[model samples]
Target: MAVLKKQLEDMRGIRYDIASLKGSISNLKTPTARQFVSPRQMMTNGKTPTKRSTPNPIGVGPSCISRKKPVRGNDPRKSAARTKARRRILQGKQISEDMMAALQMEDLKQLCSMHNVRYRGMPQARVALRKIPGLIVSDTEDLPNRSATGEEVQGANMEDAQSVESESEEEDDDSSEEAEYFEGPEASKDVQPSAH
Candidate 1:
């Protein structure tokens, strides 16, 4: 019975020593410190964020927005002239042969319809041409010198005719002076006519 008691005491001492050793080992252990990062290290390690570049919108800057004036289309004067021509044709006034040649087929049709004129064959074309005033024949091979009736006539060149008319006026003045001088002397000579 005394040996059994001694064995129990030895077992108890062994267990107590084991428990103390475990507690000392736990106290020696320390928590590892957290790692700190520097700016240079962060950039090198691809951890830093970067900003992205963007494109500007159109018509924003002075170079793009402050431009010169925009381009223009056809002249208004030309359109007004065309409109006036159309109105005259619609009023049943005869269009000149020259003007008729200048107009397109569509214009002719419009003019005829507006004036309520019946457009017949080619023969009526001549009749229509004679009715319009202010129309001069254009100098084109297709349009020969002809009256409204399509009769071939020797039409004088407008420029040449004007020059000739001015010259004729000067000649008429010279002839009138000559006539007065010859008539004054010839009146006395006729009264004494007997030296035959």
Candidate 2:
């Protein structure tokens, strides 16, 4: 009796499953026949769905896509020549000694003028002028002889020379006065004076 009851239960479960599957099938809506295409037919037709025409080939269309003609009179040769000339000037060799000396003198005059010093004398001027270049000289080894008297010819203007001389004299006087003040009787004032 128990075996018969179990068999009846199993048949009822199978019937429920079949009814649910049938409901699911009936609820599904099939697509129309025209919506489907066979792969063989599409391949045989060799037709592609049309796409919108591409935007007109950018800017001036296909007409301006050709190579542009060269501009007239736009020669690079003149520019090249100018560049060469500039290079030559920049890399040119040093000036001769005479020219260099003259330039040095001119530079000295300008410096002197700026400093309110009167630029004068051929010999003394040259000596002083030589000193000007030395101011710019990087090497002490290149200094002109300090004891060279020949370079001190009597060419410097009298007034200018006197000024330089008086300036030196004044400096000397100041140093002497300082020395006397430091080393003279005043410096030893703390000590008793010696009897005459």
Query: Highest lDDT: which candidate?
Result: 1
Error of 2 at 168 (Å): 99
Clashing pairs in 2: 121-155, 121-156
| Candidate 1 worst ten-residue window by lDDT | 187-196
In candidate 2, how many Å is residue 16 off? 0.4
Worst 10 residues of 2 by lDDT: 93-102
Task: State the local distance difference test value for candidate 1.
Answer: 0.58
For all predicted structures, in order, the TM-scores are 0.30, 0.18
Positional deviation of residue 91's Cα in model 2 after best superposition, in angstroms: 99
How accurate locally is residue 81 in candidate 2, as Cα lDDT from 0 to 100?
A: 42
RMSD of 2: 26.9
Candidate 2: list runs displaced more than 4 Å: 35-196
Clashing pairs in 1: 94-131, 94-132, 95-132
Model 1 stretches astray by more than 4 angstroms: 1-54, 57-108, 117-137, 140-161, 183-196
Highest TM-score model number: 1
